[model samples]
Target chain A: MNIDLFFIPLQIQDELSLQNKTVIVVDVLRASTTIATALKNGARAIIPVASIENAVKYASTLEPGSFLLCGERGGKIIDGFDLGNSPFEYTEEKVMGKTLIYASTNGSVAITKTKYAKHSLVAGFINISEVVKFVSENSDDILILCSGKLNRFCIEDTVCGGMIAFLLTKGKSRKRLNLSDSTVSAIKLYKFYSKNLLKMLRESEHGRFLIELGFEEDLKVASSIDSIPILPIFSDGVIKALK
Target chain B: MNIDLFFIPLQIQDELSLQNKTVIVVDVLRASTTIATALKNGARAIIPVASIENAVKYASTLEPGSFLLCGERGGKIIDGFDLGNSPFEYTEEKVMGKTLIYASTNGSVAITKTKYAKHSLVAGFINISEVVKFVSENSDDILILCSGKLNRFCIEDTVCGGMIAFLLTKGKSRKRLNLSDSTVSAIKLYKFYSKNLLKMLRESEHGRFLIELGFEEDLKVASSIDSIPILPIFSDGVIKALK
Candidate 1:
């Protein structure tokens, strides 16, 4: 197995290069967590748009009451949107059976860029095991793409990526598995911070920014491993829980 | 002091943003090591060009015997160039008092991009202490730019970067120093690998490639700490050892 990791979407020079790879997009705090929560709570499907204008445009095509305008900009709910990026905003009662037009500042942009990937899945600590299980059983070439904040590296996402890479390669022979430098570094980082993920998140740049924005509880939710154990796959412009 | 690190040049969206910041460009495997060696051996100045065409174009303006075209493509010397990117090729007998129009695949491109930086210095493990001493005594806001191989992360450069960041913050309080996620991660990676840099380089993807291409000796030179002991600063389109 060949496992490669990209710290941010900027590392991807050509989106078409991902055509044959199983791509796992990670946005630990909190797009991946929020998406998995929404899906587990029974959101119909998530249409990830790169911009607010696109989200609104996609919303106009759906039945007025069937879909909710969901997403965040700078860790806050977009003005007049139904929900922000926090997993707490995605309650069972609020998201059940609703289609979401999501437009986050980073995660959605990264997810949309993987439209050409063979299998694109959204992952976080909440659904790491599921994503790993899916990739381990079905993938030979994998790309762990971290949706870094605005094309810059963020610790929480990278640590989450490291955790996923560590899980995927655990017990595998070093000779058979081809790991990129980023993958090797990610695994090392995962081992260093795995003992206390919440603390690592709290000390991260984006984590501190979110905390200042009154989203400290969101960090706790994002740090819980395998809490929402569903594989959210993005294909054909929509993200849905894979059965 | 605020310290930031970039794993690759792609993260830098605006060159102007680097203004007023002391930028340390690291390409540990060869460029940084070779440039330091050439300068320490009595080269007049090193002019880094982004492409072979630029190197050739710049050569046309220099007196024929005064300059040499240097650099590599795919870990081998470029066709008909004066030298490959190995410290061994840059002996005092060959390079003394001559200007080198250098154009390696990754490092030169990264060096040229730092034209707007307040002070841009090339670094490898070979001249680490000298570069660190210069930056520590002269700058407040710093950016350690790892000239990652082709805008993708390379272990050697990043570990070297982590080492620099680690040294810069050695005695400082965490409360007073601002570190970016990349900076923190680089420091952790440096700590994990500092004990045996040569072994780490031998295992890195690029390092293995250079080994395969018969440049194993270059890795040994690059992995050596402060062997060259010179600060090669880039300014006014030339790199010269600071007197």
Candidate 2:
């Protein structure tokens, strides 16, 4: 297994070149969790937009009332959008059978960048096992791209990425794995922070910023492991729950 | 104290902005260790050039027998240079009272990028405490720049940067320091590998590469904590031992 981990998606020089590799885009603070929750709660499909302008533009094409315009700028709902980025707002009652136009500060940008990946899976602690199982069974070359907070490194995302890497390669012979330096550092971080993930998230820079915004409960929602057991795959610019 | 650590110097947006901040450039595999070695061995002053052309150009201006052209490419001595990037070659008798023009693949590039820094200190395990002390007594806003292997992350540099961070802020109240996520990650790595740094270096990707190239002994030179007991400060385009 050849595993490469990037602390931030900005490190990717040519996103389309990743078309041959299984790319796992992780955003633990909210995006991945919100996507999983929206899908698990019966959202029809998610159109992840890189910018607010794109989100609004994409929403315009959908029939009125069939889609919900959603996103956050600086952790608050964009003015005039139907919903914010918080997972709680993505509950079944609001999303069921509706196409969601989603834009986020970091996660959506990262997800959109992986449109050319052979298989791009959205992952967070909420659906760790499903993503891990999928990668282990289907991938020989794996790239775990952390959606850092707007081009800067985010501890929560890297830690989550590390956890996925650790679980996938744990107990395996070292000879079979070609891991990068960042991957090795990441796995070591996973070992250090895995004991109490909720605490880890609460202490993270982005997590603290979220808490300061009165979204502490969002941390709890994002930290639950395997609660939403589904792989939300990104393909051809749309995200949907993989059956 | 506010501390920010970057895995590679590429992260610096404006290298001139570092002119107000004390920058510690660490390349544990060789550059830093060799710089410290040359200074400790009584080289008049070391001029670290970014590229071979620059090194040769700078060397031509100095009087013959007063300066030596030194550097390495692929861990071997560059043709027509007096020395390679090995600490063992920089004995007191060889470098005494002579200015040296130095260049290396990664470290020298990073060192030159910090030309505008208030003070750029060369650091490695060989002279860690002195680097730490210089940072502790002199500056609060600190930047630890890891000279990663040619823009790609190298575990050894990050580990060395982490060790400096760990030693500087360990046991201090968290309220005192504003560290970035990468800083927190680096310190954790320092803690994880502190027990046996030599073994960690031996296993790192760059370390293994150095060993494969018959520089296994160089790792021993680089990994010796506080053995050199000197701080090589880069200032006015030249590096010299801090008095």
Candidate 3:
């Protein structure tokens, strides 16, 4: 198996390269963690829009009561939207049986860019094993795409990507995969920060910004490894729980 | 002091942001290491041209016997150029008192991009302390620009940048500097790889490639931390040893 990691989606020169490959999109701070939580709470489907304008336009096409216009701009719930990006806002009572129209600063853009991928799965610290198992079982080439904050590198997303890479390569199948330089670097980073992930998140730039906005609890929710086991896969232009 | 780290020069959106700031350009695999070696061997100066066209045009204005046209493409010396990017070739006898018209795949382009910087210093594992001391004494915001191979992140350059950040912040001045997420990330990576610089260089992608070309000795030369105490600063379109 050939495995490569991109620090940010901007590094991708041609989206066509993702075609027929398993592309795992990671956004550890909130977008990915919230999406997984929303899916676990029974979200029917998620329509990820790349921009706020697109999110608003896409929501208009749906029957008003059937879907929720959900997203955040600068970590705050957009005015007139139904939800912010915090995982705490995605409780079972709120997201159950709802169609979430999602847009975020980084994660949504990365997800929509993967429309042509064979398998684009959402991942974070919340559902590590499920993603690892999904990729291990599939024989396709893999691309771990970290949805870094606004086309910049994020330590949290990278560490999470590295953790996945490390786990996948640690098994007996490790000898079969060819790891890229970025992939090796990610694995090294994961090893360095695995001791206390919550502290890492709380001290990160994005994490500190979220904390100043009074979302400290969200960091705790996002750092619980393997807490949510559902695999949220994007295919056919929509994200659905991989049942 | 405010410090930020860009894993690759591509992260820099506007070059003007580097103006009036101290920018440390790092290309550990060869360009930086080779340049340091040439300067240490008593080269009069290094004129870093961003492109092959620029290098040829600039060399035309110089006296024929005064300078050497140098650079590499695909790890081999460019056609009609005097030298490839190997540290060994830049010995005392060959380069002493001769100006080097330098260009390379990544490092030269990155160096030219810092034309507006207040102080643009080249760095590698070979001269970490001198670069650190320069930054520590200066009050300007620092930007460590890693000249990753072809705009893709190279582990070695980043690790070297991290070591600088680690040392700069590890001192009592740590509390005064506000590090961006990427800066903090680089510092952590530096700490992890600091234990075995030679092993890290030998295992990197560029390192392995150089070994295939029989430039294995170059990797050893690049990994010797503080081996070359000189600091090469780029200014006014020419690179010279900072007396």
Candidate 4:
């Protein structure tokens, strides 16, 4: 199996290059975790838009109350939006049976870019096992794409990406698995911080930013491994939980 | 001091942002090592150009015998160039007192992009201590920019960048040095690969390609710490050893 991991989505110059490859988009601080939570709590589907304007535009097309305008900018809820990026806000009571037009600073932009991928799955620590199981059973070429903060390297995303790459290649012969340099580095990072993921999150630059903004609890939710055991696959402009 | 490391120069969106900041360009596989070797062996100065056409165009502006056209395409010397990107080819007998118009695959492109930097220095394991000394004594806001292979992550550059970041913050209080995520990650990678740089190079994807192309000796020269022991600084479109 060939496994290539990009520390940031900017490394992917051509979106068409993702065609025929199974892509796992990771935004560990929130997006992946939030999406999985929304799906697990019964959101009908998620339409990941690149910008807030697009999210609002998409929301206008849907029947009122059938779809919710959701997302965040600068770690806070977008103006006049239904919900922010925190997973805790994506409760079953708030999201059940409704579609979410999501726009985030990093994750949604990354998820939308993978529209051409054969199997595009959103992943985070909370839903890693489910993502791994899906890809392991059905993938030969995998691209673990980290939705870095504004196209810059972020530790949480890269570490989550590393964790995914580590899990996928564990117990596999080194010669059989073609891991890229980024993959190797990610695995090394994952091993270094795997013991205390919450602490790693607490120390990351974005994590620090979030903490200052009163989202410390969000970090705890994001750090909980397998807490939301579901795979949210993005395809045809909507992300839905795989049955 | 604030230390930020970019895995690839592409992360630097605006050249103006590098203004007033010391930028260390690292391409450990060859370019950084080769440039430092050239300067240490008495090359007058290096004009790093982004492309072969630019190198050729710049050569036409220089006196015929005073400067040499040099660079590589795919690990091999460009057709009709004076030298390949190997430190061995930069003997005093060949490059003494002559300006080199260099246009390598990655390193030169990265160096040229830092034209707005307050202090832009080329770095490799060969001249790490010298480069570190210069930056430590003369810098505050430091950006260690790795010249990754074609804007994709390469272990050697990141590891070398990591080594620089690690050395810069070796004994400093964690609270004193403001390290970015990329800087922190580079430090970790450097710690992991510090013990066996040569072996790490041999196992690296770019290294394997060079070995297949018969440039294994170049890797050996590149991995040798402080072998060249010269700080090559880029300014006003030319790279010269800091006197």
Candidate 5:
């Protein structure tokens, strides 16, 4: 079956997930990865909000002690934010049994934008295997949407999208997989790039931007594929998963 | 030097170009490659217009007999267009001395957008080497703008953009060639996937879209690296050559 993939900037694609497809939203530079990792590390759940204002507003409705605010902008922790956007930052002690009221420059906003999707899942290198498995079993026309940085194409997200497409198309006929030109190219890119994921990550545009912002360590965690195993689904405007 | 690479969809990216830096806009499927190939094949100046309306209006000003209206949307020739977007259709006989009033789905619109740029050039695999040489010799921070299909991130364009970044940063220090995560990932993608540009083209979103529309031949033409050596630059809303 033909699958449609959209490698959209977070600002634009988040709104697209509601179009009634099985949407796999990828935000490789830690949002998707972090959420997956946080869930794996025993965090209770994650709440993705569109903005800091929403995070603040939502936090008020939840039990104050039950939730924690987390987000970043320009790759740094928003001033007064409880957490910044790094997989390493979402530690067991911090995220355990707490609802993360999350906002970020790209990923979180994109995730929330997918609230209306028939089936929405946060995907990253960390949980690629699980996400792919889920999609393969479900067998719907998939939309592997990339949460690009602020509505612009970011390389990391597309690579992850490509990787996912590669996994799905293996042992399959080209005719069986209906794909867009960009989708086919991304899968090819992932196949070409699978040999050196870490090197690829280290040299990416967002990678260097984060390094400059003193988050160089984040790349290592983001590049580790399938290290974390969790399915983060978006439903009812919140993201939670079954362990 | 820090280069900010923007991967915007053609819908909006056409409006954003480098006013200071040299801008190299890529539409690898055919437009950029076609323009370069046409110029090399001895077509007298290809005229790129953003819309079919403009193409028709421009032809009226010229002797109608000396010009041809050409372009496609959703991968077929527009109604009443003199020629489709396939390079095979643009033979020396059909295009020689004939000013092409060209308007394409994504590429020409992007070229039109770079009117305010310090320097703008159309790029595709066909003329990537020539475009890269031109940019490297100029040694300005280049915006390798991809003309994505309809304001969306098309994978073919990103890979093409990555190829540009890879060539630029090769044999250089990681520090000297400061890259965004997007840039680094693009380079890695090129390195991994450059093994088979033809295979890559055959499977892209735009490539398949073209093939479905009976322009599979155009993919071969677009994927031929440096096949055409002309550098088509955009200045004051017209494409000329820095060459």
Candidate 6:
């Protein structure tokens, strides 16, 4: 199967042409893990917005009792947002049956960019095996798009993309991992770092950024492979858990 | 000293905002190498352009017969261009005392993006020591911008970036690396693959792309470290030898 890859920094979202492609939105740090955990814990739905303003406006339209404001900026929760972008904040009772209007500095911007995609699936190392299985079952052509930090390449996302490429290439050699230079390097990186996911995340730039912001525990949650099976797909501009 | 690293993929040219920063343009595959070699081989000046059309348009403004056109696309020479994007082709006899209006699929696009920088220098593995020395002498924040292939993170560029970071951060426990995740990973990849530079290049996706396009020997040219030492810096949108 033919697969395309996009490494997006948040600034170039307007230039992305994701139509007719199964766009996999990968934000390995926290968004994918948080979304998966929220859904697995029975969170009703997650609405991703590009900016905090949009999240606030979208929440105003929803029933106040059922919707909660959420998101982060500069790795910290917004001053008045109900939730910070941590997986731990998404417990079953706290999130269950409640719609979360989520926005974050980078992840939400990436999700919002792919809102027009034919099929957009959120991926992280945490649920990679499931992602590979789903993509293999629905294989036609794919775009492995990484949600880089503000229009720059982040090691975690590229490594995660590399992991997906590695699994797909290893599962069946016939698929011909016809990849770009970046893809080849990423696979090599995944091979080198996949042996220790936690260590890789802990030493990364964003990892340190999150750590400085006191979100070290989230890295552990995000790094756990194949822990969640739900696919967070974006359609009609809403990200809902897909079983 | 603070360093702000930028991973410049080809597609994000217009968005490059290098106001009042020392920008280093990196294209480890060939352009950076070619420019260094050309400058070292006694070429008077090299002009980088984003596209073949731009190269032609810029060359048109130069005195007739004063400049030669150079560049490549898909790793080969563009039709009617005077030179393809390869260092070996830029011998002393061909380039001496002449202006090269150069363009490539990736490298030149990245260089053009940094036109607004306070200072712009071309970088490659070949001149690592020289580049490092230049960076060390300057106390201003250093921007290691990787000219990713077609707006994607190519391994060679990242590895090169990592090498720069490693060089800067080695043996200094007091001074933190404070690098982006990509920077940290690039250094690790460089250390992982430093034993065999050509082998790493040959196996890399970009290397293979070059090989497939009949530019296999170009990889050898690119792999040779410290083979060229002359620095090419851009000022007033013009690149000239730094004597």
Clashing pairs in 1: none
| Candidate 3 interface RMSD, angstroms, 1 decimal | 1.2
Predicted chain B of candidate 5, TM-score versus the true chain B:
0.92
Evaluate residue A101 in candidate 1 and report its C-alpha lDDT on the 0 to 100 scale.
Answer: 95
> Tens digits of per-residue lDDT for model 4 on B32-60?
99999899889999999999999989998
lDDT of 5 by residue, A117-228 (tens): 7799899898899898988887677888888876666777878898888888889887677876557657766776688887777766677788888887788888888888
> What is candidate 1's lDDT per residue for B47-82, written digit by digit as tens?
999999999999999998999999999988999999
Ranking by DockQ: 1, 4, 3, 2, 6, 5
Per-residue lDDT of model 3, residues A1-243, tens digit only: 888898888887788978989999999988889999999998999999998899889888888788998999998999999998988888888888989999999999999989899999999999999999999998899999999998888889999999999998886565777888889889988998999999999888889999999999999988999999989999988999999
Clashes of 4: 0
Q: Could you tell me which 10 consecutive residues in candidate 2 chain A have the lowest summed lDDT?
A: A7-16
TM-score of each: 0.98, 0.92, 0.94, 0.99, 0.83, 0.89
Q: For model 2, how does the per-residue alpha-carbon lDDT over A167-213 read when each residue is reduced to its tens digit?
A: 99999999988999989988889888888999999998999999999
CA lDDT, candidate 1, residue A85: 91
Q: For candidate 2, lDDT tens digit of each residue in B1-243?
A: 878888776777677788788899999989999999998889999999989999989988989999988999988999989999989999999999999999899899999999998888999999999998888887548899999876677888888899998899988898878998888999888888888889988998898998999999999889899999989999999998989
lDDT of 5 by residue, B1-243 (tens): 555455653324435436677877888887887788677766777778888888888888987588788898887889988888888888887887777788998888877777777788788888788877877877666677778777766667778888988887778787776666556556656776688988877866667777887878888888888888788877766666555
Query: lDDT per residue, candidate 6, B1-243, as tens digits?
Result: 556566555434454456767878889899899999888887888888887778888987899778889999888889998888888889999998899988888888888888877788888988887888887787666778888776666777777777887888778673554566666667778888788888888987788888888888888878778778767898777788688
Q: Which stretches of candidate 4 lie over 4 Å from their true place?
A: none
**Can you write out model 3's per-residue Cα lDDT over B145-199, one digit (the tens) per residue?**
9998886788899899999988887755666879998888888778888899889
DockQ of each: 0.90, 0.63, 0.66, 0.89, 0.40, 0.50
- Over the stretch A137-205, how does candidate 4's per-residue lDDT look in tens digits? 985599999999998899999999999999998999988999998999999999999999999999999
Better structure of 1 and 2 per TM-score: 1
Error of 5 at B57 (Å): 4.7
Interface RMSD of 5: 4.0
Task: Estimate every model's Cα lDDT from 0 to 1.
Answer: 0.93, 0.90, 0.90, 0.93, 0.78, 0.80
Candidate 3's C-alpha runs over 4 A off are: none
Which 10 residues in a row give candidate 1 chain A its minimum summed lDDT?
A132-141
